[model samples]
Target: MDLNPKLPTLPAFYQQRIEALLARGSRRLLGLVGAPGAGKSTLAQVLASQWPGQIQVVPMDGFHLANVELDRLGRRQRKGAPDTFDAFGFVALLKRLRTQAVDDVVYAPSYERSLEEGIAGAIAIEANTPLLVVEGNYLLLNDSPWNQVQALLDETWFVDVPQDLRVGRLTQRHQQFGRSAQDAADWVQHTDEPNARRIEAAKAKADVMFRWDS
Candidate 1:
């Protein structure tokens, strides 16, 4: 795992708290979600590595609409918008992963970064496997789809970072993924920043706040 990014005090403590929660839940599921560049994925990975119990992760990114689908809908430019994901499909998968009682392998969806789309049957969430952690953006929005999804999460934590830091990181991340520097900056300043603001407003809906003081 890359530790290039140091762990801030609040996020580290949040990770410990998640591990303790997993220990107590034993067979129950837990969810960690936040906006883009909010560090939810990193937190999930850290917690999973420390959890002593059997752990499995089902990321909400797994439900992202395929690139082809986006193109067909004329929404390729607005890829990460909440409307772009297959909310119903994600809800179905979450329901199955949360309540099904079979012993066979439970196939969970997974998102492919290179392909920039979601792939079904890419991950298996082994039936009855405990300690499921789901992470993603827009999991706590009070609106229709997000509100519906929140009901499935046993516990939810929102990762909060300074606005400046988040925008800087997001711009860099976009450039790393092949976006032009100018385009990346514009995306971060416009689309991404607005989304971050919406998510920040939803922080109050989270059970806990995972923030970095520094």
Candidate 2:
């Protein structure tokens, strides 16, 4: 169960993992799961950038219910909770993309933080692309909706960073998005932390664990 202690960064490990998966010849679906601010999306972008157009990146935030829908369901306040996302929609997309031919392109949704909503068709995974990297905070969660997500991925990686660093990053991210410092700290400690705790226990589900340098 021990891993290489000298591993420099999560991205370095990811490169090797991707190489091995592609060698196996089956279409690849790589899921990177972590708490908010644990750098899942950043790692996804690293993979996409390194592979250029060949690797497609799909974000879990893309499946979040619209603000209007959240309000309608009276769940807008708990926006990042398990029930806040359109789990069925996300599952359907994953199912379709699994068997899609190389000639077909699948348009995946993306979430815009500034807009606080999802933008449909903002991402495209072409049929010719052989690898799909999906990143999000709840991909490995055990609850309904999220439980099935792991089944669709060829491999799942759990990203781990120092708790202090993760909390700091989340606070800054919230402030950058218009929250006051007090509000940011409060949310990270309360809402984000609780969710992070839930996700921390799911790390065992990952095929690999990428622990970021402290």
lDDT of each structure?
A: 0.73, 0.83
TM-score of each: 0.87, 0.91
lDDT of 2 by residue, 1-214 (tens): 1111233343655678888877877678999999988888777776777778668888989999999999999988778878888988998998988999767888999999999999999987778787899888888888887788999999999989888777777788888888999988988887788888889988998999887754
Model 1 C-alpha RMSD to native:
2.8
lDDT of 2: 0.83
- Estimate the TM-score for candidate 2: 0.91
**Which candidate ranks first by lDDT, i.e. highest?**
2
Global lDDT of model 1 = 0.73
Q: How far is candidate 2 from the true structure (C-alpha RMSD, Å)?
A: 4.5
Clashing residue pairs, backbone N/CA/C < 3 A, model 2: 102-127
lDDT tens digits, residue span 81-146, model 1:
788888877778777777767666778778776667677888777765668888888888777767
Q: Pull out the clashing pairs in model 1.
A: none
Candidate 1 segments whose C-alpha is farther than 4 A from its true place:
1-16, 23-26
Candidate 2 Cα outliers beyond 4 Å, as residue runs: 1-13
